[model samples]
Structure formats: C-alpha cells, structure tokens
Target: MSRPQHFGWFLARGFGPHGWGHPYLDWNYRWTEPALYQESVRTLEQAGFDLLIIEDAPSLGSPATIDLRVRQAFGGPKHDPLLLAPYLFAATQHLGIVPTVNPAAYLPYTAARQFATLQHLSGHRLGLNVVTDTGSARHFGTAPPPDHDGAYDRAEEWLAGIKALWNSWPEGALIADPARGRYADGTLLGHVQHRGDYYGFDGPLNALPFTDGEPVIVSPGGSGRGLGFAGANSGVQLALAPLDRESISAYRAKIHAAAVEAGRAPDDIKILFAIQPVIVSSAEEADRVVAASRDPDDAAIAYIAEKQSSDLETDLTALDLDAPLDLSVFGGHVSQGSIARLVGKHDVTTTPLSTLLAAHARLGRISDRTGFVGTAGEFADLIEELGDWGNDGVLIWGDLHPVTVHRILDELVPILRRRGILRSDYVTGGLRANLQAF
Candidate 1:
C-alpha cells in the first residue's frame, strides 16, 4: 500500500483545571482540561490529523512526578489514555489513537491484547508507541535497575514475543460455534518460545492479537537498539526530529540502513518528527506568543537542575552558559539524544548561568532544533519541506492552549488540502488503513 501523509497531536495531563501549570515547578503545564482535549481531538479529526497521541504515564517517573503532585492537589481524578480511546473513537471517525507503552512496566502479552482489542474496537485505528526508558529507573520501584542497554535488550525480546503472539493465531481460528460450544480451533494457536539474552517466554499468548497482521508498530527515533528493533519489525513508522531537513534526511538514511541490515525494505520504516507549532493570524502574533510562553534564563536553569535532580546546585550555577556542554562532567546521568541536543544548543562555558538557562529553555519541539513559528502559510511550507526532505509527517504540540493547535486544524488543514498534501475527508477505515499500513 502507498504511504499516506500522516500528522498528529499530543494530549498530556495538566497540573490544573485551566492548564498544565504548577506553581512549584518552573515548567508550564502541557495537557489541557478534559473538555479541551475532547474538543481538540474532534477539531483535529476534522482538520485531517491522522492520529492523536494520548500520553500515558503508567509509572511516576521524572515528568510524571509533576503530574502526580498536581493530581493530588486537584482532588484526584481523570481518564487515562486507555479510557480516552473509546471516547475519541466515538467522537471522530478516522483519527488514530496512539498510547505509549513501556515494555519494562507492562507485560508483552497483556499490552498486545490491549492494543489488539483497541484495534478491533476502533476498526484498526490503534497504534502502539514502544518506549524503553533509560533515565528514571528508580521510579519503577526497583532498587537496582537495569542499564539502558539492558532495558532495550529486554524490550527487544518483549516486542518480539508480542509480535509472535500477534501472528500466532490465524484468521478463522475462532469459529464461535454456539451449536458445538467450541470457541476456538485448538490447533490454530501457535506456540512461541524465546530464550534471548534478556528475556525468556514460552507458548502462544492467552489471547491472539491481530488474527491479521496487526496495528501499526510505531518507533520513536533512532537509538542503536531502536533501529535494530524496527528493522526486524516491518511496517513500523519511525518518529524522528521535526522541522530540520538535515536531521530528517539523516534519520531516514539511518532507518533505511537499519532496514537493509535486517533484510527488510528501506521504505518499510516511516519517519515522523515532533512539531510544536505556534500558529497565529499574523507572523508577528505567532512570534509574540512563542516568546511570552518561554521561560526566563534563571527559571530555565532552575528547571534544568530540577529535571536532572543532581543537586550540584552551586557547581551547575557556576558554569558559563555560552560554552558547549562538558561531556566529561555529564557523562552517565543525562537521558537520551533528545535531552543531549537541548543542552548542546547553548554554549555553557562562557555565558552567564541565567543566559544559558533562557537559551536552552524552549528546546525545539523536535530534538531542540528550531521549527515552525509563523502564520498558516508558513507552516504549510514547513510541512511540505519535511515531506520533500524525507520525513513522513509531524507529531505536533502547541505553545499555548487549544487555540494554537486548534488553528492548525482550522487554518493549516485547509491550506494543506488546497495544496493536495492533506486528505479532504475520512479514507473509509481506521488509523492503520489511513496510514496505508493496511
């Protein structure tokens, strides 16, 4: 099937009823209110957003730390991604629902069954974003956590196991024979066994996943392990850096190379990037909003310190912000390439601590690279450029409330439609079908 142009919006948890803001934390809130999220999803569906990425926090890690406290203060409650799925499905006809899953926390079989059921219910509109976390292992409630490589090792096997279970049962295996009282064909559930370095599993999953191939398996970015995993799994969409053409090209090349190494077609892997759009009626208005929402230099520094939780307050504050990050000083503790890029942008050696903080504050939506911040026409241009440069689509977030992102659906979608870059209406099926992965 031909690849369909894909675009998405992310809805996260908020710290308050109005926004994701929290007084204790330096960073502003990310998730809007429930009513806003619902409205946003519907608007995005109409605007032709191929998917809506509803972030799920299973374990309270670094980011979730902020969310957890906020929830407590707000008198406790809200729907998680899983519960939100059915609502979104009912609200929109074609938009995809991608809920992130961390393999270490969730069982492979259980996750497979959950996603499979969602796909079945949404008519295949579900997609899985597999995340093997690195930085915040302490939050997993394990005293001694596995290393990054170790986590990926287990994750790789877990993913393989899930895929095996998905394919274990063939179509027509479930006769549901009411007269005979036999629900399944006993011989059809193929057993799966694996004794790899990090994981060991046996037999078919209790419940079959696809009965067909399954939902789109989406991978975020290119780590060595992530690339290898995607290469082994065909039809996986790879999410990469948004807006930067150079990064997009490089990522696509890496994905294709990984696919070739794994004996799969290069084009089988789809590449997407994060786009934090700041849309407005005029270019000036967009710029103003972007600037207003950003953190001050000192605030940025404090936020970084809080994020790292290293507590080397004096030493961190002593460094100059204009110099490149001292790799020797920050070798092991930092998270991934994503965070690394955020630090790399500002030279922290000579600049003042406050200066450094503000510079690195608004890390670009995708990998800290500067991206779209203009009128509707300018955004359309950026999207087209991304496509031409080899990225499949963008996973978007906005600076302000629903208005900034909502405008994309209202304004930019129409422009994309006019340019033949976006679909005019629902394509007759679910997320997987719309993505042309069917």
Candidate 2:
C-alpha cells in the first residue's frame, strides 16, 4: 500500500465563486458573515486536509478595470485572511490555517506579533503563505516595484527580520511562578536589532513566546528566485508547473537540492502542487467535464481572456480571438505570475495571434491544471503514481464551489482513504507535525 498523502485547500478568494456566476447560491454563502468560510474550513477538517491556504494579493488582477475583476472574481476583494484565520482556527482543532502575507506590505515587528499571537492562541495550527507581490510598482507604496530577483532579495531580509523578532522571546521565557511572584524571565528575552537592506527593526516582539515553534511557513516557488526563497524558509513549498511526471520530478529534485545548499535537510520542506481535481460519479462524466473546461469555446475564451490579461499584463480584449496574434507586440513586456505560465506554452515572441489567445483562454479560464479527472478510484491511482517522485502532497484549487468541494470530501477522499493514500484521521500535533507526519 502507498503512504498516506497530504492535502490543502488553495483558496484565492476566502470562499469563492470560481465560476462566473454564483453556482453555490443554494448553499447560502453571503460574503458578509463568517458562516460560509467557517463551513468550508469545517468541511476540510472533516475530510482531514492538512491545511487551508488563504491566497491574497494587495491589488486585483488585470484588464486595468474593476468591472472585469469584479465580474470574474479572479483574485479580487477578498476578506482579509488574517482576520478570518482566527475564527477558523477556533472552529477546527487539526486543520492548519495559512494566510498569505506580503512582507513588504507589513512591518516585521507588526507581522511577527500578529502571527505569534495567532500561533499561541491556535495551539500552533497556524501557517503563513508568503508571497512576493510582483504585479505592479506601487504594491508596496514604493516609487517603482522591485524586479524579479529584487523582490526575493527584499523577502530574504523581510523574513530574516521577522524570524529575529519571533526569536526575541527566548525558550521557556514564560515562567508564571506565583509562589515566587515571577511572571516571566526577563533575562532570557531575545531582541531584534536587525538592520538590513530592505528593512530595519529594533527590540523584541512582546507577544507571549510561541512555545512549540513558529507557525508553518508556506511559499509558492515557481521561479528561480522563488525556489531559492522557499528552499531557505518555506516549511511547505507551493508549486505550479507543466502537468508532466518528468517535469514534476525534476522540479522536486531542484527544490530538495536547494534545501541542501541552504544547510537544511531535503525533507524539511514539502512541495505541494496546485491541483484541480475533477471527481464525478463515473468516468464518462469526468471526461465531459474535463473536455469542456480544457477546450473552452468562444464564450469561455473571452471570459478567461480578461483574467489572463491581468496575469500577462497584455490586454487581449481588443485583439482577434479566433485569428492568429502578433506575439512580437509583447516583445519585452510580459506578466510574471500566471500569465508567464500560459505564455510559456506558446511562442510569445513569434507565435500567431489566435494561438496566444487560445493558450491564454485555456489557462486563464481553468484554475487547477494538475490533471486527474475521473472517479475516486482513478484519482487515487493517479496520486499514487505521482507519489513515486516523493513530492510531499497536492493542494486542491477546489474550484471554490460547494459542489466541487463536497465531491472532494464525499467521493474523492473516501476512495483515497480506502486505497490507503488519505489519512482516516489526523495524528497529534500542530501544523508542522501534522504536515511532516506524511
């Protein structure tokens, strides 16, 4: 039997309307109340998912208009995950709540205190997904945005400062000895006298020291700089790549080697691929659903093109959808995140117009690309086959809809458990221990 695999929910909007319209309107999900998000987290806990990543960005995505972003709901206007995380942690005993934090957007002292307080309160069931916001120059309220490698350079310093602040409260600092009237050992307090290239800070975080450890650190490492950052800091690395076994295996090997270079054990960091699973009642249903999603028609292409423009930073709305494109127009200007991924498949420098538009439509419209489309039995078989790479686990894009989410908990997970690839129940520990258990 294969080892038990781990799972996480990769949510862009807290609880989303991933498709254009409200498919889960019957589920009574109003963005105003915490009830909907709470219910989703509870469902994940029931299915024994290791963590839930609250994916966020400071600004909304492209077409350079609010109408498009709002219409699509593609990574826009999310309730602050940090604010929502505490409520989730309170509700679930085992599920890890990881909120995306942009280091540049926050002061180190402020972030250190924020996460430490949550970690202490949640019994260390907290994890933080760190992102380097490369969308625009003004994301950090700076004159010009940091370039690709520059963003990571700042992240390195930012995280170092945060760790220093977290370390300020030394081990065993909370000595509540009533008999001796000693509240804490001041002598053991750690300090953060950090002055670096990107940020500077002094003094220690005052929050109660995290007794167990800092919350799990999560990072999406698809770029070279990102891989280095994840290797050095991320407890769990988020990966998105071409859906091929060989590519996935080579990617894991690179990350593992990065960790070794950083003076850490290869297994210390787990890589969880961003996957969208299509689990239906039977193989036939799966085929139809997948075909529609992968080979989207004109309407689907236009719908997705708006979102892709945001990622690629190239507006395709005015261009010919069915006609071939002039790729040279985007010679030097290209998007970095999801846009880069779609463009990678086509020859952006020389490809025709329609081909570029099609590629954009396919990736932009569809979120999860870890292609396992079938019933639970087939899904489990696919997972076991991929596990041969020794990649840690897969984070479900989950489609941000209740029906899809329910299928994962109800149908997909059961088969995984029966096949011995999913945990029947959680073992004892916080986020890190629970994650490393697999």
Candidate 3:
C-alpha cells in the first residue's frame, strides 16, 4: 500500500499576520484579530496539509540587552502564537495547531491544563511541540538552562509529569447523570500526584480530559540524545531534511532504531523533515534566486555575532570574529549537543572564530542550495523523491506573499495530487487521526 505524504505549514515569524504595516498584503484582517491566520489556515486545509506548528521563542536574541534585539526586531514585535491557536481552530475543520513551549518555563500543571483545554475545545485538533531551551528560562528566573543533554533529562521528567496530570481524569469520569442528581463519578477521578526528579506535579488537572485522546506530542530532535528522547516520547518527530539521500536514510534508520529501543514499534513515530521548496515558473528564475549576491562586512559580522550570542546563550559581540577564539572562556559553558552542531566537534577548538562565522554566513544561504528551482511539476517530482528517500512528511517553509502562496496552492498542490502523494481530502477524524492515516 502506498502511504501518502503529510505536509505542515510552519507559521513562524507570523508568516502573514505581522505584515509590518505593509498595505500590499491583500489581506483584510487586522493584526490583533484572527482574520490574518484564518486565511492561511484555510489555504493549508484546502491543500491537505496535516498540521500547523506555531514556532515561538521568548527572546529574539540575547535577553540581557535591548538595542540590537529591538532594532532588528529579530524575532521580536511578536504576538503570541498560542493566542492564535483558538482562532485558527475556529477557522478550520482540520489541521492541528501545535505551539512550541518549553516545559521547564511553565509549571507542569499549567501546561497540562492549557493543552487539555485546547484539545477539548478544538475537537482534538491540538498538539504540543515540546522544546527544551535556555533563553526563555532566564526571564522567569527558573532553573538555569541545562546543558543540552541535561535539558533533555529535564524534558523526560517534565513530559512524564504533564502526561500524568492529563491522565488524572480517568476515562468516563464525567457521569452527567441528571436522574441520579449526579454530575460526575467522584470516585473515578480528580487530581494526580506525580513526583519526578525534575518536577513534583499534583493534579486533578483543573481542565477536563480532551474528548479525543491526549493532545498529540511533537518533539524536534536535532541531536543524538534529542532523537533518543523524541523516539521515546514524541508521536511526531521533526528533522530538517538533509542535503543528500544517504543522510536521509541514515537519519531514518537511527531514529527508527531509537524508537524500537524505547519499546515502540519502528512505525510508531512519524518523522517529518523541514523543507522549503522554492517554486518558480522556469529554470532561469530559479537560477536568479539561487545566485544570491551578498557581501559580508563589519555590519554583517556584527549581526552574525549577535545571532551567535543569541544561539549560544552568551555574549560574543566583544570578541573579534576575524581571529581565533579562546576555547577556555566558553569551554564547558557551551551545550555539547547544540554547540557541537553549530561548530563541528573538532573545529570548536582548532578553527579561527572568523572562519566559523564565515561558514555560518554561507549556511544561511542554504535555501539557495537545496530544493527544486524549476516548474511546479518538477518540484512535485522532487518532493516524491524526497519522500522516497525516507521522511513520512515535509514541513514546508515559504513566504506568505500572495504570489508564493497562490503558486503553491494552485500550481504545486495539483501536481502533488496527481502524483498520488498528497491526500485528496481530509479524513473525518481529528488531526492525529489524519496524521496517522498514512
């Protein structure tokens, strides 16, 4: 049997909503209302996308300072994605709304009740993207951000505790028997006592259980331990699609084995990779887009430094990007799992700081490096090949401009349908059901 591929629209940077006061959007919704996201959500459902993951971060850059952060509006000037989930749910019949949340930042009970409420209200269309990061933890004076592996450890306990709270309300706990003058089976439920290494959560979660099962859990695994954690817990695991088929095959096998080791069936988890397909009418246009022109100078260097500071959770602006960096200052401070990825294991110690910055500057141009640049049909073929390589689905990141969105909806979606890769219509059940269908 052929399992069709799933697609999700990753709505980060407020795709169309934070229009920067631009009048050309052709969208009538004000920034404060659901009107902006409703159209995008509607378009996604029409094109048979599976879910919409609303990416969020508490800080756009280093939380310690304000000038560069506010100046560039890096990821600032944002409206909460959680604020939009309800509106999105009201606007569409399908498509899961999974918002990113760091478990450590919120009291486990609050997170549990919030998602459970959303699941019930959205008809089980809610999913939660669990993220373990340090930037946001600073704001609330929570425990210091754990090192990469340590963060995952906290996450394991955090998720377990949250699930326990969700499970506090047993199945059929609400009796609603008017004849007996009873509203619920008091003995059957209320409150959970979960004591874990990282958290002590006591419930009866104030919210009732979702009508469907617990809201879907999503984890993005960027490192080895992260993958292991995702394998053990996530219903859907996200990966940025690799540049080659070998890496794709290797990633799938690794994550699949991790799931099996965690006592789950190899097929139990759906692995979706992030892909941004640059659709164009012809090959020449693709070339022009790919041949991006940029000159890296002092200003570019400063921006890169700020970005690094933000990512590494430290300050790098004072250091010289054109010279070798001292390994001692940041030696143990850097999170092994994430930093190793940023700069290679060997280069972290040996390479000059300038070279590292240059590499990342080039990497930021990856959009020019990957994806098919031809007509929509050609891009569809590329998608099939990518799916054949391994991922169960792709998380598409594209501009929300009318031309780009329309080309995808009009030109690309049809080809995907004709090839039998995209679903013709949404399944009758909720987001999890449709996701697991393939």
Candidate 4:
C-alpha cells in the first residue's frame, strides 16, 4: 500500500520560449503569449498537481557569454515570471503558482506590497520560490555580491524584513463594522521599523491582512546554509538528490534537524525532490530510448554542450572533445555545483571532454530500475518507493508547454491516483492546505 503524496511541476525554462527546440514548436502556440501557459496550467490542475514553480535568472550573464546564453535560447530571453503569475492564477482554481524571486532583486517593502496583493487576489494560492542567486546583483547596480554564507545572511534579513511588513497589521486591526461607521482600529496595527546590515525599512504595509494565511514560502538550496534557511523559513523545500533510501533518509533528517533547531516542527517543511523522468509508451520504446542515448552522436554532443555552456556561462563548444578539460577555463562567477555535476566522479585531469559530455547524455532504464527512463507503471513504482521511504513528494521538471505537460502526466497521474499515491481531490483552502491534506 502506498500513502498519498504531493505533486508539483517545475517550469525549468522559466518564462522563456516553451517549445523552442522540440518538435512541439510546430504546434503554433506562441510562447510569448499567455494562452499557452494558461492551457498547460489548467491541465496540471486537472491532474491534481499541488503547485507550479517557475524558475528564473534575471541576468543574461557577463558580456563575454551573451552568445552562449541566447545562441540556442538555453537561458536568456526570459520574461519576468512574476508578471505571468496572474494569468496562471486566473486559469486554475486550485494549483498554486510560485514564481522564482531573489532577495537581491526586490526591496522588502516593494516585494511585501506586491506579494501581499497577489496573495489575496489568488485566494491565498500564491507562493514564493525564494532564491539567493547574487549573480544578477550587477544588473541592480547594488554592491558586489557577497560570499555564499553572506548571501544567505542577506536573504535571511530580507525575509525577516518582508515578514515584518506582512505582520504589521494585527488580527484586530480591521473591524469593518459598517453600522457603527468604524472601519478599523488604528491602534491595533504594528509600526514595523527595521534596519539591518543589508536592508532597512519602515512599514505598516498599506495592504489588507490575510485571513487564510500568508503566501507559502518555497525554497531550493542543498547546501548546509540553504537547508538551514529552508528549515527556518520555507513551507516547501525544492530538493535534489539520488533516489536511494539512505540518501533520501539522510537528506530529510538534515531538514528535520534544522527545523527542530529553528523551533519549528519537522512537518513544517515539505521536501519535494526534483525529477525529470522520460515517459514512454511501451517497455520496448523505453529500451530504445535508453540505447540510443548510450552513445551520443555529434548532434547530441553539440546539444549537451550548448546547455552546459549556458549554465556555466562559459562556451564549451569550441573545446577539444578528446582533450581533458582545463578547470581554469571556468570563471570565478561560475557555480561550483555546476562544475561538480559536469565532472561527476571523473578526474578532470584524465577524463576527456567527450567522456564528460557523454555522461550527461546517457539515459538508463527505469524498468530495469536504474534511472528515470521508463513506462508509466515503472515511473509510478519509483514514486511509490519514494513515498515508502517517507518522501514528501516529487516535482516534475520540464518546459511549461501543453505538449510537454501532457506527455509526462497523462498516463502517470491515473496510476498514481489508483494506487492512492496522488490526491483525487484537493481540500478547501489554498496551497498550504493542499500540502497539509496528506
């Protein structure tokens, strides 16, 4: 028997071109318009997904890497996902919409006011996927971005400042007694004055108080400081890790311990691991997909290189495939985690560039139970196993296009629902209620 778990969709490409490189581009749906995203989100809501998290990075990167960012539309040309949330909210009744927000980008007062308005407008279904990426700080003309721990420190201060504004209005601040001509109790509102190392704000936010709850806080960070931030602030922790029992258990234990240390219950945070499973029709097709990727052709290698280039912000297409990669080619601004992922268990001094790139293109079979390529039944089995290990849920990652959304959820949702691993109906309330329903 399997227990019910939450499910969500991650718009991995942010608010950029949805079906740009895929065959689905021929579907003729304009990615710039709102109709495409609205249709796709409705599909997710019908499939019983709890939320949709949009990923965003506001920078096109340094001048040297502009070509790498937009050459194949891998990373650049993204519109503000925050501006797109209202359209998503209007299209669905239950699915929560979480757009990526950086503390460095928006000031606490401005963010609080904008986010508060949306929370009430969405019937309390709004969520914030807070990120601490400081790479874009130059775009804002702020001081130089801080180090890893310092970035989190700024984020902690940023969140505290936002919350202070949110709580400025006390429970009895609004009376709304029309018969007595009394609208509110002026004395009940808090006068929040905050001056921190990174930010300072005075607030008694000019927004109505939330009756259901504030917007749900979502975060994605795997570092110790990141996990601590999640435990202290996030309602949902967007997780990434191997799917094995021990790895899953240890990851959750760290989050639980962090929550306990922060004076919060372990259940306060939901850890949903990110997975982009390749769904196929038959076991034979799954085998073919896996086999075809085992030895990537030149075209496949070029495709992988383009994506890695965008992420690393360093062009890798010109590098010699047969030669070992020079780690020095990566700039100081490049993410260490991205480098680790690219060089997975391979000695950078000995492994050829072709071998490193090929590792990423290889796909394994979920039927034989190695990786995420498989039929719907095999995919559900993996989900059920995660639930059995006390996992909260999984976030399906991909482009936010109707074709891509249907491709993954069409068969998988029914299987999950039948096994009681996915919710058939959401409880009344907002995103927080949905997460708590299980």
**Top candidate by lDDT:** 4
- Once fitted onto the true fold, the runs of candidate 1 whose alpha carbons sit more than 4 angstroms away are 1-4, 12-18, 22-35, 62-80, 135-143, 176-183, 193-202, 208-212, 234-244, 286-333, 346-352, 361-371, 399-401
What would the per-residue lDDT of candidate 3 be over residues 374-416, giving only the tens digit for each residue? 5676667667877777668878765344444676668888888
**TM-scores for all candidates?**
0.78, 0.90, 0.85, 0.98
At residue 292, candidate 3 shows an lDDT of 48
lDDT of 2 by residue, 230-339 (tens): 88998998888765678898888989988998999988998888877656677677666666666767777776677765445556677765565555545232535555
Model 2 residue-pair collision total: 8
Per-residue alpha-carbon lDDT of candidate 4 for residues 293-392, written as tens digits (9 for 90 to 100)? 9989988988999999999999899899999999999987776778988998899999999999999999998866677999999999999989989999
Tens-digit lDDT string for candidate 1 (70-122): 33322123335666677667776778777667776666667767777778888
| 236: Cα error in model 1, Å | 5.1
Sorting all predicted structures by lDDT, with the top scorer first, yields 4, 2, 3, 1
Best by TM-score: 4
User: lDDT of all predictions, in order shown?
Assistant: 0.61, 0.74, 0.71, 0.92
- Candidate 4 stretches with Cα past 4 Å from truth are none
Q: How large is the C-alpha RMSD of every model relative to the true structure?
A: 5.6, 3.3, 3.8, 1.1
lDDT of 3 at 36: 61
Full-model lDDT, candidate 1: 0.61
Instruction: Name the runs in model 3 displaced over 4 angstroms.
Output: 1-3, 14-32, 60-65, 179-181, 292-321, 324-372, 398-404
